[model samples]
Target: MGIITDIVLPVSLAFIMISIGLTLTLGDFRRVAAQPRDFLIGAVSQIIVLPLVAFALVTAWRVEPVLAVGVMIIAAAPGGVTSNLLTLFARGDVALSVSLTAITSLLSVVTVPLIVVTAHQHFVAGSGGEVAGDLTVTGAVLKIFVIVTVPVLAGLAVRHTMPGFALRFEPLARRISAVLFVLVMVGAIYAERANIGSYFAQAGAITLTLNIAMMAIAFYGAAWLGMRRPQRIAIALECGLQNGTLAIAVAASLFHETLYAIPAAIYSLMMFGTALAFVFLVTRGRPAAV
Candidate 1:
């Protein structure tokens, strides 16, 4: 059952990626060229600043070395598709949000493994080998490319080859993806059920603090970058949010380490409540998007 659950996640994620590709085009990226500063800010914050923030939070919170690496992996993850929905709700620039998601997702094939390996090495050195066993550099890289990049490319290929068929399948794809995402959450919870009490006791505060901190970093980072209101909201949503479900899948399937999966599991639970509150605060009294 655990092995089957592992297979389901990447398959569902592939469908979700295909749906995104079907809805996007090169023109979306071209639009970013007209707003170079916003594009640069969003990219840099995601690729550089956010991961650093995660590392700092882990250290400051005194998270266990293994769990700290988990936090960094989640941090290194791309902006989720859900951010586009949240941006739409916040009356943000949907195009910018979509563009950011697209770019970040493309970049994660390089960045995620880099972040994971770097964190693994750092924690191993710092903790005198108390880190979660290192995921082999070669195997980790191969799995990331195969598991993440392959599905994204396959999705894109389907979109390119059969636009009509792609459109027809997208809604169903989304519904399936949504259901699978929920199931992943449920499975994660069930898998962690026995350890829930201790997991929370050991790392709940760290997880909560990191969640709030990153969200705040994203919000303030966007504003500080002088992004317009809508773009700021979009960047905030993207920066703070992540695909924790995917992280859980990586931990469970790719890494086969349930203990290492707990941080993402905790994050999956925390983000919904926090992100909803953020959408409320940012969008509550604002006029609706046109």
Candidate 2:
């Protein structure tokens, strides 16, 4: 796992982001105009409600200070690519899913840092003890820009300037990204193995509760906002699952603490199962509505 992280994982994540960016055009945002309500609900739910819910859970659970920061980091990071796959599985709006990914990921460079600072100021100030000089907002942004945004922009540029090249390489890029993401998960798990038992033993109920609540908010909140079934599914999955790899990266690179990184590692493993159950429970017998 450590070997993978030091090599394949970083490269793959960059490629994955680039692949997603390659599929984009200005028209993606234009499409949002056609379904403003769905997009608005999804953005609000993801950027606002999801983090708030996470913060509340972290507080209620009395998570270890470092672990609470991890939760907030996950909340701050962009929605995962997994959301799009889950959206497809649940037969939701694919265009909306793609648009949401593109928009949120692009916005993450700014939003994530702000979220991180705010979470720290609010949640960590009283907790006492600064992490280290390495864990600054600028450091977090630089890491994210390198690992996520740059590859995406590079892929997007390639797709735009050399369409034939992009067409040929797109699939390979996505495969690389997937392999990298998996490697990041493995690295995180291995790195945090010693702390896993303690984290779950103390934070397990809180983690599960937070996951369930986030999932519920996606569907129920979207429904309350009068979103259609498809949009609800997309928003729900996005809310429930987070970019755990990014969280771990930020925690490790920016914060310099494994304790702060472990939640994301555990979350990466836990969310897949939790999200699958959610899909089955929410979509069963309904058929693919969208």
Candidate 3:
């Protein structure tokens, strides 16, 4: 379990990031400049509002401190590649979804550390004295950079240098990433199998509420902001789906405790069901695409 949490999880997360990178290009980032207002709308909704909402839930619910930190970690995560695919399914703006996911992912190297450390300070440290092996901002930034930014950058370089190869291999890499995600969840759960039922019981309601709340927030916010239907759908799913793998990695690797990862793991499972229903609800009785 130690080896799996410390080593295997990090390596697998890096590869998952690399797979996400395979689908990106410089243009994705440039989409920010190309459409700054819309991008800002989505960015604020995600990077700013999501964590704020999580904190509210944590504070309102008075969740267990470590688990509250876990909730924050998952909330802090960027959108995952699955959101891009779901955007396609919802007939939303795939290009916009890809752009949002790519930028948030790159931004996470900083954002994740900040959120985690803040949550740790507020939840764990505030609740009790400082625990041993507390995660510092600097240490978390470095760890996330090594496992996240560098891998995504490497994948981008591969795509640029070998477009044909990247095209041929990206699907395979994404499939492998999916398998790895499942394995990581299983490993995390198995490691804490004894407490699994309690963790889920404690975590299920909050995580599910977070997922549904954020989906509603992003969707209605987009609509209220006068975004088109497809853009609204894309923003909604992107905010809802979160990078749980990265959240788990932080809990398991940075904090050295899979107990903190329980919410993220459970959140990861709950999201797919909600996302599928979201897609169905939005896309039903609709045209194939815009």
lDDT of 2: 0.76
TM-score of each candidate?
0.91, 0.90, 0.97
- In angstroms, the error of model 1 at 57 is 1.0
lDDT for each residue of candidate 2 in 1-290, tens digit (9 for 90 to 100): 45555665566666668888877666777999987888888888888887888888888878777678778888777777778878888888767887887788877887787787667766666578674564556766777778778877886788789888888886676566666777787777677787678877766666677778888878887788777888788888887778776776667666656677677767777788999998788778785543
lDDT for each residue of candidate 1 in 1-290, tens digit (9 for 90 to 100)? 27436577677667666666765666767888888788788878778888898888888877677778878877888877788888888888888888888777767778887887788788754668644445666767777777667776676777778878988887677677677777776776677788778887776777777777777877787787676888887887787778776676566655546766678778777877888898899877666753
Off by over 4 Å in 1: 130-134
Model 3: CA > 4 A from native: none
Best by TM-score: 3
Q: How well is each residue in 183-252 modelled by candidate 3, as lDDT tens digits?
A: 8888888898999899998888999999999999999988998899888998999899998888888787
Per-residue lDDT of 8 in model 1: 70
RMSD of 1: 2.2
Candidate number with the higher lDDT (2 or 3): 3
Which is better, 1 or 3, measured by TM-score? Answer: 3
For all candidates in order, the CA lDDT equals: 0.75, 0.76, 0.88
Model 1 error, position 289 (Å): 4.6
- Candidates 1 and 2: which is better by lDDT? 2
lDDT rank order: 3, 2, 1
